[model samples]
Target chain A: MALRFALLAALYEEPLTGYDLTLKFKTRLANVWNASHQQIYKELGKLHEEGLVSVEDIPQQGKPDKRLYRINETGEAALSDWVNTAHNRPPTRDPLLVKLFAGGLLDRDKLAHELADTRQIWREQLAYYRSVEAQYFTSRAEMPAHFRFQHLALRRGILGMESNLQWLGEVEAMLADLAAGV
Target chain B: MALRFALLAALYEEPLTGYDLTLKFKTRLANVWNASHQQIYKELGKLHEEGLVSVEDIPQQGKPDKRLYRINETGEAALSDWVNTAHNRPPTRDPLLVKLFAGGLLDRDKLAHELADTRQIWREQLAYYRSVEAQYFTSRAEMPAHFRFQHLALRRGILGMESNLQWLGEVEAMLADLAAGV
Candidate 1:
């Protein structure tokens, strides 16, 4: 739903094709929400049917005709109304945590392997966050004011990854102690 | 699905009632997974119907009957299979980030207020992580071997929270800069 609102908001700024919205979502909104190409296409059709967005057909010489979307007045009103309202708390369901909670039922070796694997995955995430941080700090000056808001979200992502990396290190130490019964 | 496995894993150690599972989940597996009573009850019923768990009723004179659950051989096999196989990547979605992405559509002051609120929330989360960290470290000597695995997960939670806090700080700074148009 937030993704829909974001797409509408972007189109409100200026008419954009589905492909354009996808790119914008990645660079500007990837930290907050993600939408696959299929989802984007589906939502565009839904929004058009709902009269919240209007589609314009742009001729392309050899390729498929681009469907440019612009927010309708109804869409603008809906967006405005949504912006004023507080969103509900995000729902969460994590499978890995469940596995950990029941770890006592498994052999120590198997549990250790899972934790080690998780730590490695988080390490990779930390590296990705650092890369994102570097990318933003180096190139953020050229972005628009609204985009700067998106950058704030990216900063959060980077920090979140860093925290996970640090925690993973401490956990490794504890796991080693357990393995040795120390 | 993971929750079911977690419960089965817990029952694999020894039969436990739903209440006991909740308490154990909060402390031992809080980092890895979380489940409400409603969810646990629902899943327990499903597991029973599937013949993956057996529940024995322990009558209490004045209190509710204790429904102690133990994992059946089938359940154990399921858990073993899950551990050996590769799992899908963890899902990641943050609505706050989505809001920030479409922030240009919102009034500037409104966006700033949301950012401030988000920062405060992360600060509270960091404090909670700190408390958890302190508890884990203080009890390190007396904790069980399996607990060491759980502690590793707890550390991950702490680091994830800390990283979010740090990101909040950077975001606050960026918002301030944007407000100042610098």
Candidate 2:
């Protein structure tokens, strides 16, 4: 459901080929959402069938043709309705949280190691987000409207990672106390 | 899938009737995941058929029989494998971020309204989590091992909600700036 809106949003920006839209998911939209290139290509077809998105094919010399997608007016109205509607957040499919919930069934030390590994992963993620912020947002006050919103999404990701790291540290401290029989 | 894992984890804790499992999902696991009462009953039946869970019909006086479920050895081993394996985090399906991504197609004021509504929702969620933490964790140092892990999960929810609220504030400020045509 949201994937359809995501495709509509990307095509709203500009006319882009299927390959280009997939790249945006990998690079630009990685912060807020993650859709595999395969998934993007599949959903684009569905959206086209539903008349929310229109595709135009361009013939290439000595190459396969490229199909570019753009959102139609109906798609714009749909996207607007989705943006305004307040609903429950998406379902929770977080493995890490489930692991923590079931941690008593795991070896304490092994669980701690896993927690540390997860923290390390987030550390790298935070670094990556920080570098992105530093590179593109040095002069955010003058940033165009679309980029400004993009920066907001990135900022959300950074704050989320930071909060996760903080929670990991606190949990690790508890694990130490448990080991000490405190 | 992860929902199966969640069910196994709950059954691992203790043998409970399907109703009890659904209630626990609504309360204890609300922070981490959610499952409807009907879904819970359906999955419990599947788990029993697969031999991952065993059911005992306990007779109740002047009441309906209760089908209590417990994890079998196979289920325990399956859950252990799931807890130990490090895998990809679930896809990020944040609607607010999607809205921000499509802000260009939306009216600025309506976007701001939606943002405020989202922040209000999170504010309520944060309050709920804080109350839960306060009710359950009075003396952390002497807590049981399992409860400690549960506490860690609750803390994760609290921190995540806090981060979300902060991000909402920041984005709202950005929206203000956008309105000022800055």
Candidate 3:
């Protein structure tokens, strides 16, 4: 549902093929949202059927003809309405907490190990966010003004991962204390 | 799947009723994960049927009998294995980016409003994290040694929320700039 409107908004800027939108999503909005190629293609069809977007075919010599999508006026109106009026809280469900709460039943050693593994995962994620930040911020002035908002999202990702890592360390320490009967 | 193991591990500490598990989750592992009463009951039943968790009835005078759940040895082993194993990368999906990408198709004013609304949501989340941190840190010394790990998770939540709020500010600024055509 949100994807439909987002796609329309992107098209409003310039006509793009489904493939182009996917790439844009990875670079520009990678921190906030993601979608599989299959999902993107599916939404494109829905947007066209609803007349929110129009499809154009460009003839090509050897390669497959590209199906370009542009937001129609109606599509623009819909995207605007959604932006202004739509509910803003994104849906979130995390399975890790569920496991942790239930951790009491497992051996203390086992829980400790899981916490360690979770910590490592967060470390990797933190590194990735930092690398991406460096890539974007190196030429900050050359980037689009709107990119500042995306950068903020990236910062959140980094902090979130770092916090998890910190939490994992605490968990590990606690487990060790419990094992030693301290 | 993670829920089952979390619950099993938690039971390893001490037998708990479903309600107790829910409260512990909120206080102990709230940063890493979250679950509702409905999910708790559902998972409990599944665990019981699978012979992973055993339920003992505690008679109460006025209230219903407390069904205390304990992890069986088999469940313990499973939880242990899970903790030691590698976890798959978290699946990524965000609706906000999609809307931003599609912004060109929508009404400019409407898009601006949406960005504003998103900023407000992030602010609220940041406030919540701060409150949680304040409450936890106030009695830091009294916390169990293992709680050190839990504190790290709490910090992560705090930082993550702060970063999100910061991002929203940048986004809001960009939307304003776009509105002003500057």
Against the reference, the lDDT scores of all candidates come to 0.71, 0.83, 0.67
Ranking by lDDT: 2, 1, 3
Best candidate, TM-score? 2
Model 3: runs farther than 4 Å from truth?
A57-65, A86-88, A91-182, B9-14, B19-28, B57-66, B96-145, B168-182
Docking class of 3: acceptable
**Span of ten consecutive residues with least summed lDDT in model 3 chain B:** B98-107
- Model 3 DockQ reads 0.30
TM-score of chain A of each: 0.73, 0.83, 0.74
- List where candidate 2 sits over 4 angstroms from the true fold: A60-64, A180-182, B59-65, B180-182
Model 1 segments beyond 4 Å from truth?
A9-16, A19-28, A58-65, A105-144, A172-182, B9-30, B58-66, B108-126, B140-142, B179-181
Cα lDDT tens digits, model 3, A112-162, are 665667677677768878998898766736556445545655765676666
lDDT of 3 at B10: 65
The top-ranked prediction according to lDDT is 2
Model 2, DockQ value? 0.66
Question: Clashing residue pairs in candidate 1, if any?
Answer: A97-B32, A97-B33, A159-B163, A163-B159
**Against the correct fold, how does model 3 do in TM-score?**
0.68
Q: TM-score, each model?
A: 0.79, 0.90, 0.68
Question: What is the iRMSD of the candidate numbered 1?
Answer: 3.1
- The true-versus-predicted C-alpha distance at residue A5 of model 3, in Å, is 3.0
